[model samples]
Target: MKISELFYSIQGEGKRAGMPSFFIRTNYCNLRCMFKSGNLCDTSYTSWHPDDDKNLGETSIESISDKYREFLCKDIVITGGEPTMYADELLLLCKKLKKVNKDSFITIETNGTFIGEFINYTDLISLSPKLKSSVPFDTPQKKMHDKSRINLKVLRKYNSLYKAGKLNIQWKFVFTSGEDIKEIKSLQSEIRFKNENVFLMPEGVSEKDLKKTRPETVKACLENNYNYTDRLHILIWGNKRGV
Candidate 1:
């Protein structure tokens, strides 16, 4: 796999927030996310400029599993850049993790642009479909990012899998403003996913910024009957990497 950083830390976002877990952050992303607040993607080293980390190189799936075994953690989160970009390797990694311990929970966080066999091995799919607000203005990637950010067909497949009990899924959206709710509603209407599975998170990497957006976020969640998730990692460690 094209690996970036591996660490044992608490699950920082979505349904498993605060749970002790191991992280396998894959390098390279399909999208370059620049939020409406003018903050570049929080983990830009893995996306916007992957080479920023000279040590960002390949590692075997065996080594990844060994590290998880060392932690003996109940959960392992495979995040990105875009973990789904390495679909076959991700499948192998998930298989190895299950082989090590069948009961260990596995979560794969992705931008929802790719769907693959790896979904079968994962316990939960943390699917964050990027909103238009994530498009970086005036960048060469803006067109590509805007065009590739959302895939309704892929989203529908995930929803169908969840409906058939093949795997669990959470539809998480990073909101920049209440106007973002319109896009979310439109997607939910087309996807026909259950509202309960929807999670709304404010777009911020700082505690203060998150605090600034919390009220509107909470209100939006309440109004739409969606769940609210805070970036616990950000609150606990500012915007630093490796939790």
Candidate 2:
């Protein structure tokens, strides 16, 4: 299988924040996000950019399992370039890891596009749906705004996973300039989930970008009674990957 990078790190986001964990970033993605422009996407030092050829690495399920066994961390994070882009291989890998450590917790950090195939194996699903302001509708080559963004099919799949109780799912909205927080609140209302399960993470790649979101955002979350998540990895490593 095509793997991007595998290493041990602390859980930087979501409910499992601060926990020591292992990260397995897979190669390829269903969506073509613009990373070079530094507009919407979070560019990692080790290259989390979906289309970067230099970031590509090769590994088998057995090797990955061996790495997990070596680290022996209870929490394992399977992240992307849309990790679910290769669901069959991931499922096999996760199953193998479970056999090695039955109590291991598996989390999938996804763009919420391909939940249909991976929901069963994942213990937690961090659903970070891209807001319009973050994803400009433009191709990387054209260097012009395109306005294209994540689809509703992805949203529905997340809802389905929540309803099925297959995994603990949380809605993470990445906010940037011109984003409509009220609209996101409305969407949350429509979904009918308690505010505790919804989170707002400032759209950022580095500590500087993360601090761009005013401290007041946390107050806004409290006023709205929603959860606030910080990008701990970025805070600690400043956009570095493979931590």
C-alpha RMSD of each candidate structure in angstroms: 1.0, 3.3
**Model 1 TM-score, all chains together:** 0.97
Candidate 2 versus truth, CA RMSD in Å, comes to 3.3
lDDT of each: 0.90, 0.71
Clashes of 1: 0
| Shift in Å, residue 18, candidate 1 | 1.0
Report how far off residue 24 is in candidate 1 (Å).
0.5
Off by over 4 Å in 2: 32-40, 44-56, 137-148
TM-scores for the candidates? 0.97, 0.85
Off by over 4 Å in 1: 52-54
Worst 10 residues of 2 by lDDT: 141-150
TM-score of 2: 0.85
- lDDT for position 201 in model 2: 75
